[model samples]
Target: MLKQLSVAVLTAAGLLLPAAADASPARFLDQSTIPDLQRAMDRRQLTSEQLTRGYLRRIEELNPRLHAVVQTNPDALAAAKESDTRRRTHSSRSPLEGIPVLLKENTDTADRQTTTAGSTAMLGSRPAKDAFLVQRLRSAGAVVLGKANLSEWSNFRSTAQIPGWSGVAGQTRNPYALDRSPCGSSSGSAVAAAAGLATVAIGTETDGSIVCPAAATSTVGVKTSLGVVSRGGVVPITAQHDTPGPIARNVTDAALTLSVLAGADPADPASAAATFPKDLRLDRNALRGKRIGVWRKGHTGIDQQSDRIFESTVHTLRSLGATVVDGADVEDISWSVKPDLLPALLTEFKHDLNAYLAATPGDHPRNLSELIAYNDQHRDVEMPLFDQNLFVEANATDGNLNDQAYRRHRAAATGIAQRSIDDVLASNGLDAIVTLSGLPASPLDRPGDPRFLSSTRNTSVAGYPNITVPAGFAGPLPVGISFLGTKYHDAQLLSFAYAYEQATHARQAPRYLPAATG
Candidate 1:
């Protein structure tokens, strides 16, 4: 399966690239920001077709080892040509114009690429239209570079599963360390962004999917408040928490991408009430007077090096003229216990996934029960690493949002999560809460669940915005610090993260080390 996928990806790359004699200079592609690329294009030094081909070549070169991209868009070069024509006509749309962006495989696109969600059960499934966010990207003149691999079913299929493994794409390796997990559902998005396979990528989070992978891969990820970016046409884990956001090598790119993606969508009811700032440009001085809260208890304590890095990060914040409030942990909370979250998520998954699959075009599983049965029938490929226990559990639910027990759990879980973040911020008088995004990426061969130290739960359950930026390194692996804020604070969080990122300049491109060293 892995060999066949690689052959398909390589063939796609071959089709996109120009012949060697006709190739353009692409040495400037590495670590190039959106503004930098735009400036280069403005100077007549580069074109969108060249940039797109450069990325396609990189994907072909690296994806054999990283498994980051599952498919490259057949229309990518044509889209780039269109962007070039628009630019020559002085009608460029947005900051993202001509940027090549990867979509996580779960994000539906009405094109040749399949929206499989990294599962063979949906191997040939197609969507009737572009996902709402994809529509926005196209409107902004961004090229849909390709579809990235992800944890199968967005990591909802099995509790025992590896973070970046999927039936279709195999495993996605961290760019920094091939032996380490990418900490995903958004695994490929983060890896591709970090490795410069694309200008940026879109990822969905239902808890730590976005931020966790961003931290692991040493990239920037913004988990916009739920509904800030519509979930329509994306594979659903649960509408209550799932949100599509940008993962990029820098905050400016992520923020710019978010500006394009954020808007109310009629197809997604959750987006109806959401609002966003007209401009999301970053302010380098945004953190000067901000009061940032530090939740020491949120530290995972598994990596002493990460703990030291967090302390250093706090000092850096203070040096940036920010007031640092220590020990601002969420009060009176069962930080270790989450009794209601599971039942609520399971029920919603059954209901929401059924709806999404039923609407998807092509012949495939149309409901949760059908998906489970398909897995059973193809156990060799789908269950090679882990069983679909979560699917079974979700299918056992009443699968109705109106069920009294489901409603109770949903309300209680969301309420507790909201209060946890809101009360802490209010008590501390904070602009944002800061903590380690999680422990550095764990080795893939280690048994049991990976130890994650992030405060992802509080923000995720409350449907708030969370941004993770590269803080520093723990040995050869990178660690990230998170800036989390209440709902609709997406722009503010971006500003804070941007300031910190500029001040520190801590992110380093991956060396693709075989393993980490102490």
Candidate 2:
């Protein structure tokens, strides 16, 4: 009860007095996720039409200024109409049957909306049908609320770039601190979830895309192991690193989204291990006496602000009866992984993306070389804020995925990361490792690019599961702490997060701001 009261107090105060504190219609409406809203609908308070209209109204009032939502599905109202029809005529829903959700624009919706990937090159093209993820959402009765704005090409188009800027969708401001940035490429998806534009939003991550944006936006984000969630129809990044995860205001919402979207899809070959656990919502005492190893390296020298917040989080976890064991540095953490990281990404990007693009024929550049050439051709709009240095470099590399050098590099990289994780857990008999999820929030854009260290690689290279929960604030900007562990430890990590959340309940909703200041 104390924890619940704290969450309510924090939510109320934070929503009303958020960093930057910009008013948003989206934040004012019934912004709960599908499950919470479903309960309200069941109580005969908000009909599906009313729910849909509220979000539409929010989108209308804010999208123009914030540029968070670009293309709302034309069929959204009709879909809501259908949901209302069912509610009045029938008795129950098929899970999220009437829930309105925003797809990250990278997700193919197969509706009137086109998946532009926030780029002008594919602005007008529409997929022949819904992407597999969208199809899953539809299968569970979710309304394709709209296509959200995202970092163009999911942030693969440029290097050292701004977070929320897109050629087609313009710039999506941080809902809490507009000047501070919402981080990307899942910027719009996380913002939509935070500002009440949608109940839930789906964001794809290659490196820090999903988790960074979620931390910056004060939402819950899960970055599954490489093959856990299907990457079937989502836009391509490095196939070895990409997974579409859930971003929501709470862990339960995220878990619920994961449950709805999990399972095997023949379309995405990597999703074979997508089996979810039964009874995902664990008890509040799940973390008592559980081993929690502290990852000290990831947080040692980042932001002074984030470090202070993470300290509070560690203290909180210890107070809740969790056995806290500190330290992550060892001979193996990144011993020889640094030299081989870029080569692997370049090789995988060129190989996997080409394969995925061949399936989706379009007028835009279809391959890595072509994309680099296209950027060279039109460097003005695409390279105005940042250069395509990463793409150009990757395009120049040889993708010898089958060669001796590639094999050695991949082996060494994974070996170091995985060994470090194992050493930490095994030495301490730990269930999960906790660390600062790190706010990769947007720095103020200027003549140069906004810069920050990428934190996703620590677990990504290891092929581990990671979950981020809201920890506390760094000057009103949200920072999160993570619980991660060895391969296929999704349930264990979730339970740890749930217990921490139940104890701390630290998350607060965003109040869209035009700028940030005390």
Candidate 3:
């Protein structure tokens, strides 16, 4: 009788509450930030093992429906135990001393998890070694919980592809609304962090991968300036634009991840200029009395609801003492880049892919030719939507990355984007730019996203930094506002974003429903 009474008490507390919980819905743990978790660990309120067990158990119960996680580390528990030992020994390393972090599949992890980049062709493939940025993560004492599924080859595999579908990991369901899209190719990392699968996750972006998924999942993600975070060992779409960044449940945590991930690396030449931008926490209130340029274009494709939400975001920023200067006023602002974007992407894809394939493990169609042939053989599965259009177009190009045409296009596109985007900020005496993130990615029921118009493109094509914080929700699902800026302004960028996020406090956990559309 006494034991039965004790069991009932535990049930009311929401401690997983048995198979048929008699209490309210799973309250889970406190579901807070990395710093909060670290303080709790410091006070012995929670052990790393306890925290990790809760996450693993939540995955066992919830991921069957969400499909947000692609793989789990077999050593996760053992790592958690080691973290506990280190804590007891008074040797805590950093804020993430015992926190679990998930890495996008494209980021190499020299471990049990395979870096397949969410494609079956690379199934069983493992990266030759840990990517430089990934190695930095390990040094900060983060337990590698697992790898998050991403859009195949970071969404470079197909032109008319679904946002979250990948042959290796399948379609990761949107945690906020099951049938709705999570957006990608950082879909898994964003969703995993939003759904409490881990404290934070690292995601890569050549374009919209980080911001889109963050907006879709009610989290914060920073798409750092080129070279701020080393791109070595990460699967690439364009070496000129590719970068890895952080996705977390909140802006502060994302800022923390940014600090650890940014550094100079001998492996990636781009890192020569990346010796800074790791001090995001230094200026915690960068938004005070600062000028922020409001982007004039790229919100036209948004839904009506997101427009209203964006207006509120502007008001919120203004109230925080930011001078909101409007328009795309700059030198060469009219100069466009997409005319050469496809050519540059294709050329880089072929060269970079061949290098990555040679480095990683696998036994399947490799190289641009073999992959094209493989796509031809599996047309029903691979080409049901988009033809191997990119593959074919790329096949027609020169393998020479230094060809005159390739070099010219690369120079023109990157120059116009970088110069104009920065000129707008400089001319306005602005520290950053603000814009609606995009149409809160239309539902996932269809084959593709609803012709989404994202502002991250400018920063992406320009190789500048951009971050998205939870602006607020249109309904039950979340939306984000982007902060974009000049070259290597990663610290200033994070400070502005973190201040905005703290002021708004506008994040919530996903309800894991069907669709939030009205």
Tens-place lDDT digits, model 2, residues 107-138: 87666787777777666555677777778887
Which model scores highest in lDDT?
1
Judging by lDDT, tell me the better candidate of 1 and 2. 1
Weakest 10 consecutive residues of candidate 3 by summed lDDT: 17-26
Q: What is the lDDT of residue 501 in candidate 2?
A: 81
lDDT of 1 at 412: 90
Q: Tens-digit lDDT track for model 1 on 73-108?
A: 999999999999999998999999999999999999
Global lDDT scores for all candidate models: 0.86, 0.73, 0.77
Better TM-score candidate (1, 3): 1
TM for every model, in the order presented, reads 0.93, 0.88, 0.91
Deviation from native of the Cα of residue 288 in model 2, angstroms:
1.1
The residue ranges of model 3 lying beyond 4 angstroms of the native Cα positions read: 1-31, 277-279, 282-284, 300-302, 328-335, 379-386, 446-452
Better of 1 and 2 by TM-score: 1
For model 1, what is the error of residue 244's alpha carbon versus the real structure, in angstroms, after optimal superposition?
0.6
Number of the top TM-score candidate: 1
Residue range with the least summed lDDT across 10 consecutive positions in model 2? 13-22
